[model samples]
Target: MRDTYIIGVGMTKFGRAGDWTLIDVLEYAAARALEDAGLGENVESVFVANMGAGILNRLSGLGSAMVDRLCLFPAAAETVENGPASGGSAVKIGAMAVGSGAVDTALVVGGEVMRAVTGWEATDFVATLTHPEAEYIYGVTLPALAGMFARLYMDKYGVTPEHLAMVAIKNHENAMKNPDAHIQQTVTMEGLLHRPEAVVNNPYVAEPLRMFDCCPVSDGAAAVVLCSREVAERSGKPLVRIAGFGQATDTHAVHEREDPTELAAVRTAAERAFAMAGRKPADVDVAELHDAFTILEIAQSEEAGFFERGTGHIALEKGETRPGGRLPINVSGGLKARGHPVGATGVAQVVEIARHLRGEAGERQIEKPRVGFTCNFGGFGNNVVCFVLEREG
Candidate 1:
């Protein structure tokens, strides 16, 4: 296979995009990425990662629509949906295309416009990701399932609500520095502990998880330009090589899993990625974990080998996952503070790591970063994808 590199990455500020349509967000990010890559007129093909355009915007064929809007009329285009992991999956496919000589350069875009509908409608739409008969039929939303997982994790690992709060506080602080982040306000322990009984007060969204613990319903898009090593070299920009990638899946229903607390898919994917990169967890200088909820960060950090099982909370307590700590995790604020716009989130994680490896993250930049890793989980860890990125010399 030929080597693949990310030449450019761009993303819209994620949040409630009041009036913008899904196609609008896609076009915005696609144009910015093409410009960043100095390939405004040379895109060969396009892969779009969109999960719920039809449900959210009453539109399909988003890939073709994006290509049209970008004025790449003749470019081949298709949409890829793999639950919330759609973004990372699209990037993986684009990288594969470039690496396998199917396409020299590909534009991969991940977008979702969720705010076009009411929050209840969006919530119901997202519920389709669960097992229809056994899960969703039983009123299991993402937060409810995640809360169940969090409860299990807490029971087994001795994690506390305060530990989860620390994760939120850290990410919100990090988001303050990221212009593209959705929720930028810094929350103190006291602020979270004390709020108006109506809004900011901790009312349980799902048992044991407050509204703040849940990722916001967001509408945004992110795009990345992938090219073969030859194309990257010609662009005259620092290269972020796709050193390793791994994807895995498990039972769709959460109850079918033998252990709810153990994300076996994440462990397997991370192991494969680390092996391909010929690097252990210690070799990673930074990371971006799918923190759809705060507990997920801790669970995934342990599963990815960054911290020992049941000790992820200890790592958080010591600030090992914060910027300027042992290993900075989620300097993009992760899905929690960064805003998980479904399909956009996974690819957005890749964008952040690419920027970090290129030393282009500005305020969130890690010191002398060399290797970076990203993990994107879908459907309560039913599907997991991990990538290891390295600076190409």
Candidate 2:
């Protein structure tokens, strides 16, 4: 297979955009990515990632709508949906098309207008990601399931609530440097510990998972332009090669898994990716794991081999996962502080990594970065996608 490279990446600020429509956000980001690629009308194909714009905004046909808005009306357009991993799946398809020489250039976009509905309504909409007959009907929301997973992880791994809060504080501190991050507040451990009222002020969305621990419902979009190596070289932009890609799925029902704390799919996917990239976890200079909840960062770090089994929480305590530490994870504030616009998150992670590898991450930039990794988990780790990126000399 031919190699694929990301030539350009762009994203809208990930937060509540009270005035921007879904189309507006998509158009804005897509156009910027095209300009960044130095291509005006050469896109050969388009893949869009959006889970439920119809349910969220009563709008459908987002794929074709986006193509038309970009004035690439003649190009073939397809939509990909895989719960919250939808964006990563789209990027995977786009890269595969370029790798197979089926398309010289492809544009992958992930956009969502989730804030169109009220908070409770958005919660219900996201809960539909659960199995309908077996889970959703039983009133299982994402937060509720995540709470169970967090509780199990703590019980099995000796992770505490303070560890979880530390994850939040760290990411919030990182988000302060990210212009596109959703939450930019620099939270202090003292403030978190001393303010008892503030602890419960945000209130518990689900037991063991408070509001601050949960990612906010966000409205945003992100896009990337992928091309074959030959085409990328011609564009004259700094390139980050797609070194590895792997995806795996587990039983849709969370209860069916042998261990609630262990994300089998994440382990499988990361192993495949690391093998493909011919690199170990230590080789990764930076990473962006799916931190929809703070506990997920800890669970995923261990599952992805960034830390030894049951030692991820300790890694956090040692500051190994922070910037200027052993390995920086989620310098873009992550889903927790960066805002998780479900469908848009996976692609956004790629965009951030691409920036880091290209040395264009600005304040969040890592020193002498060579390799970056991203993990996108869907529906309580039932579906997981991992991408390994390397800087091209």
| Cα lDDT listed for each candidate | 0.89, 0.89
What is the Cα-based lDDT of residue 162 in candidate 2?
Answer: 82
Provide the global lDDT of candidate 2 against the true structure: 0.89
| TM-score, per-candidate, Cα-based | 0.97, 0.98
Residue 123 local lDDT, model 2 = 90
Per-residue lDDT over 225-331 for candidate 1, one digit per residue giving the tens place of the 0 to 100 score: 99988889999989899988889999998888898789999999899889878889999999999998888999999999999999999999999999999989999
Backbone clashes, candidate 2: 0
